[model samples]
Target: MKRALSLLGYSIVGLTSVALGGCGQSGDAAPEATEVPKDFASSGPSAKAVESQFGTPVKDRVATIGLLNKRNNLTQDLVMKTGESRRVGNVIIKLANCERTLPWENPPEVGAFVQVFVEERASVQEKLAWHKVFSGWLFKDSPSLNTVEHPVYDVWVKDCAMKFPGEEEDPAAYASSSSAAKASGKASTAPAVAPAPSASPSAAPSPAPAAVPAE
Candidate 1:
């Protein structure tokens, strides 16, 4: 009976040790689960919705676009020329071309072709990498025409830097023109002042005529 009791005590101690060891191993091996995200891409800009129109050639040739970060609601403006790119956080934006319609054209519009590259992980097993997520023309007036299909970022057109006739002139030019107009108006309204003609001596001629008549 004494031997049997000793054996039972030894068994209980061994089982408790094993249980503690298993719990430690489990804590070390498992991790918090992360939910995989779904793709956020959408088809945008039907052919009929965004018509590409270009009249005046691009002058300065620099394109400007607005970028939005959905996670934090932050927005930034990106300026680039054709074949130029700007990087932010893990995203890259490249410009191809920007265009605008002539002033006379109906329903004025502005558009730009953009390419977006993003750094993302394809899956849990893969490492973070860069990928071209979206590339298309985006319109300033109509943003729904094209969309950047990523979980973190959104891009849209603002306006093309090119200029057209009958459009608003440069601020410097406008100011100069205004100043000149004001000067012209003042000149036209103000009356001209002239010096009066001086009267010359006729006394010598009158004296000669009086002497001749007396002789």
Candidate 2:
């Protein structure tokens, strides 16, 4: 009986040691789960909608131009002519966060196009939602870009007023065959642009062609 009791005590101690060892191992084990960060990308659909209207991604990144301090307009300026400010004007835009590559014409099979995208404040997501309501009014009267936003003209300032209707002009849709892309070769890296005419005030104005094609 004495020998049997001693053996039972030993067995209990051994079992206790094994249990403690397991607890220690479990406490020291590495974590079993991990989290990955979300990837940042340019806005995709908004960018695509704009790309469909405009021939290419004109600017490397989305840009924002403030409206005339006086008129406070939010319009898109996507033209690519010299003396034309490459940044465009008078609107604020936060770039979309995803990018996708689609087939584009080298010689530009489409007619004149306007790069279209929603404009939003740099700090807010909901700003773009409100922007859609008034975006249609970007163009109404032709106000000189300088006269509209100059600090000196602040006396004419107004809030929440839309002064222009978005009357866009598309000439590329009807232009001649010269604008088609090359059928079988590498795509051209060169931009589709025309020579800038000298900005001489005294240059005799040519008669306005009735049906001008878009560049």
Cα TM-score per model: 0.51, 0.17
lDDT of each: 0.69, 0.30
lDDT, residue 112, candidate 2: 19
Write down the worst ten-residue block by lDDT for model 1: 32-41
TM-score of 2: 0.17
Cα lDDT of model 1 by residue, 40-96, tens digit: 122222222232344344334677888999899999998876556666777777676
lDDT of 1: 0.69
Best by lDDT: 1
lDDT of 2 by residue, 124-149 (tens): 55453213212111212222322222
